[model samples]
Target: MRSDLQQILATTDFHSSFDNAVPLMTHLSAVRPNTLIADCGDFFEGTGYYRLGRGVLERDMLLALYDVVAPGNHGWPHYLESELHRITVCANAYGRDGRRLFRPVDVRSIAGRTVAVTGIIGVQAFNAVPYGQRVGQRVTDPALALRELKRAYGQVDAWVVLSHSGFEEDLRLAEACPFLDIVFAGHCHSDAYGPVRIGGVQVLKGYEQGAGFAQARPSESGWEAGAARFADASSLSLPNTLEAVRARITAIARDLREPIDKVRAPYRHTVLDRRLLLEDIATTVYSETSSAVLLNETALRAVQLHGTLTRGDVLAVEPFGNQLVSVNCPERTATSLVSDLSALAGPMVVVPSPLPSPLNAFITTDYLAGALHLPAVPTGRSLAQSVQQALTGGTR
Candidate 1:
């Protein structure tokens, strides 16, 4: 009976877990012997390590550990490269050179059974593309990607889709293909406790930063899947390479005392009142693109700060890897957006007032824009770029 059960472990939305990266891999490796480990994407660009290291330092560590990987919306282009994604299985992503970045499907032998894994991202990206990374690259329609993967690896004993696409997309995929047995959902950032059944498929989701990975073990009739029970890995020790990266990060922190500008009254960001900050950010975007700025209030997830401003301070306030995008929408929709946002507190948003009947709008993040169903054009100007330009060498 024990021999009949096989374990497949997975993690999604790591966002560059600097702490205990390799040691966590060690822990995972030792925890489940002969288990096939897979990582769903959005695995980079959160902490200072990404900013300083360009994700290479942590990328190498992840390469050594994960058996197969998928590129999330934020971890695109870089993670799509050959070195990191050689064992990857992403159906939708392509390079600017018009080449498929990774193998569409991976088949692994686990517990005398064949386990197949593949990945798909949201139709719209959560993170904007960094400059000079890849020009004119496209993530092909995910629905088509799944059909392609299905035709290729349809006969596998157990199949899993690491879906960075939202929950609804996963449900659609599950309905389209009855062969799919399990789905690990991402992009929504939910810590789903149990499985949501759609046809024969069981979908599970883990929270941000590997709150805990998903664990799926074989059952008598099918697989049993859910979030793993464990402590957050933030306190654990990192591997030697990452420890060295930490050392560099610490050193960099020492020299970060240079003041960029001064702040008036500490320009605090509070949920109770976000008007001042939004208007400030919107004004900047308005100047750059000549578009009314609309931003998801979640962009300012930092605590109150008012004092001498540093480069670090600005980056901390706009911590997400979002870029400014220009969108053309009916001015009335702007009113509708603010109205809808006013009604809901969870997904708060801000749009500059008195929009022209037909006007151009500047947006901050794709995740929010997509959720709001706004049409946008990519500007390639990142949040860091906007902050540096807005608050650098200038008092506010």
Candidate 2:
């Protein structure tokens, strides 16, 4: 008989996988009794479903899983002091007993050995957010947090970091913190699996949106502990119990999609008007809204220079959920921002070229310079600075 120590099942990028998680959880439970189920991160935000107030969809899904949970970025935005209290109160009410429901770290004893699972939301919440928005949240700094995690090295036989940080940061953490044995990561929607040995530490990203779960066992020589298991959630159809739970969630999402009464104008941007539109959208609007105006300005400049933009393009340019905010900056600060935008527009910056439409003539010379490397330099500035300065005038 195989030694029945502890089995670890973890999922990441579960952006409201609440309904979908039921079947996955049920299957996992049936296969491995008393295993640790962890919802890594992005459980709440970034989906059209949540935008329709379907965060409750995720909340209900988590309620059913009966496992250890940790904070993701999506969960953080909705986190209020009151909500935290309510979550604790409700977990107690639900008769699901464990320190797993809403805690940063949980330690479990299995198969005569203790294991520690430490969950960290990605640093994007800080580095990616616009300036003023990152305030007052108790986020663990990845570098400092790793030091703390090191303290627990000898305390537990296995240390797992359940992270919502993107792949790069997670890999960095895994390399930096040799004490960590496994890292289950999310964000960046990377469908990577297996033991990615980064400086001898094995890191794993279990794909996204509850598509699957990653299972690993510790062997005598670290994570090479034989073949790890990656179970695909899509491979299994809904079981009867899960079918019922899923129906409830689908009905809720369906009901929420009904149109609400709100008066809003349709947003329009055309090739002829895109430069002007981008100028307004970036400097006058987005800059005022977020902390990192330079970042926003770079994105807008890319859009304005290239007349064609897509939803994906917009997202790539501004992935962070930065809102429009303005702070008073002295002329020097504003000047520095202009300089930064100029640097971002240099020849090395490979911007997307617009499709040739009949509307190309309407594009300004400045926009053309950055987009097509046109030699039309405005009287007194570098190619990059001239384009950026011209964009501010709305004439572009």
Candidate 3:
């Protein structure tokens, strides 16, 4: 009987699920006695107080399961190199004292064969968010870094690319580069589980936030031809180590909640004011700054005008913590960007009646009126312009 090929258990976008580490480690120990576990970046960031210090917590938990780790986009932030290094040092200090904390890639011998694992931090050079707001340090060119991985392919039995570039970019990379045998993706928070063949490459995205894991093994057809599968950790009805972590999170949430003690005047809504506010936020606050805001004032106005605004509604509209960033671009570029935003605008559905509360309504009205009449002047562009172009189809 042929021995089972070495199993590779890969997870990504864990954010800060310190509780997930225990169960994941337990599962790894039981299922694949000699498996290699990898964190494909974005293992940090966007987490609440409960998830804070998760990097250190997870590293300690991985002592019994994981052997390797790769950085993701959320793993680093501006002026936070020390924080990243601190996590690595702490992880190293806890387990395998002599081992290195993070590397571009790790080459290992599994089942009597050599396997190469490469990691690349997703680039923010093309991201629409302001430079200072995007957490985690970014690599300049992910493709170029992957090229280095290609050189080691021939020497390894299997090659895996752990990426945090989301599904679309991963698909594009897989099509453009053929050497990658498997790509584990994160950052899009997509629910697509199981192995998908994209341009002859096996791509897997294991949901998000410690929801599950993806497994891959070599079949009789050989490494390149083997099939892969995904398993949902939550559906597994597995023992819940995450519950303890959730409890801790709940306590933190309660501590964060405090009554708004300030007495404020009752607010009233006005159609003209609402329209102006929406226009101002989208055009002056968002457009004037980020070149590409990925939003529509018409949609916001429609929703608010219909009395459908809610706390959750506001969050969904501006989900990303985007900052206003000024970019210099030629008039043509600015015009094209606006055209792209117009084309991208889609329909919206509002749930309440035809009136709602209005807060700080005047700021918006004045900003919108001023912006609408302002002339479009172009100047030399910056990184923000490049990012806008990338978002608006100026770049692939």
Candidate 4:
């Protein structure tokens, strides 16, 4: 046991899998009282909790926990509202008034050394977010931000940067910013297996969804790092549970528990194999719009169980908030547009609609349609609503 060595427990892209992550964080904190617990951001999204509260739930929980974090692109849509109890640092994310959203750097005095930590979100994140939602904020180049952060904190015993920037970008930043001692990277969502050294900086990243954290011990030259220990939340004695959070999540689940459809088998999700869940989505969407050439495979987020499917179960399978948008276009044009998704490997299961004409009415997401450069309008029916309608026949 390196009890004499100071440790820093870190995580990244923790999308409020707090049920699993919070306990781990608190446990490590208890064991290493002087340990610095932190996150690399993308924490304000995912799960039912995030959907219900629009980050209020996460903000409250994270702030209550007093975990240090950097901002990720997920919260750029609500920059001002996402600020936590602790100072959020990211040298790149700026305000409409040309000011930094959070502090450019946060210096923490823990154990025997002065540790300065900073954060930066990816600029590409701004492009992914809805244009309307990100009016006031701007994500500048992280490289420039790092330079500014270095200038601000001229000298420190240890310099740690909590980067929401992906691993590749972090590598580039690490090589360029020689002043950095340690970089905790996020957004890419890889465990990294072990830490990597770029130039003189020791970089680390933990697993996604708050499953685990990475521990790094200070070394004479730099730092010794390793893979994140992914621990099952159930394994912990007296596993962490929040009644208030549970009750809220439970209430949402209960509401969505109404039976949708009975499936003979589970709608399993596998990257290599096509999912039956897409067939369900395709059929439901067809029932709603009667549009031909519906595409439902690519946007899928979860898998469904066998037994009776409920709204909750269906939601678990398709968690994204994307709505079903029906648009009219030519069959040639629609097929051509979908084929443009060069990144998609598996064959897209296209379900034909009953509607006829040079106009091929189709269904897709606003974001996806924009990417395909397809002129599509929302029929105002959300993907969830369409599924619910398909299951219940609009009786509800």
Task: Give TM-scores for every candidate, taking all chains together and pairing residue i with residue i.
Answer: 0.72, 0.57, 0.53, 0.77
Off by over 4 Å in 4: 1-5, 18-22, 25-32, 75-79, 82-86, 230-259, 264-276, 279-298, 326-362, 369-376, 387-396
Whole-model lDDT per candidate: 0.64, 0.48, 0.45, 0.62
Task: Quote the lDDT for 132 in model 1.
Answer: 35
Could you tell me how far off, in angstroms, the CA of residue 87 lies in candidate 1 after the best superposition? 2.7
CA lDDT of 295 in candidate 2? 24
Q: Model 4 lDDT vs. the true structure?
A: 0.62
Where does model 2 exceed 4 Å of error?
Answer: 1-5, 17-26, 29-32, 77-104, 127-134, 138-140, 224-245, 256-396
Ranking under TM-score, best-scoring first?
A: 4, 1, 2, 3
What TM-score would candidate 1 get against the native?
Answer: 0.72
In angstroms, give how far residue 245 of model 4 lies from its true place. Answer: 3.9
Return model 1's CA RMSD, one decimal.
Answer: 6.1
lDDT of 2 by residue, 27-116 (tens): 665655556666666667543345444466566555555356555545554433344323321111011242223444566765555777
Clashing pairs in 1: 20-238, 266-306
lDDT of 3 by residue, 315-335 (tens): 222323233333333333433
Error of 3 at 292 (Å): 15
Q: How many pairs of residues in model 3 come into backbone collision? A: 5
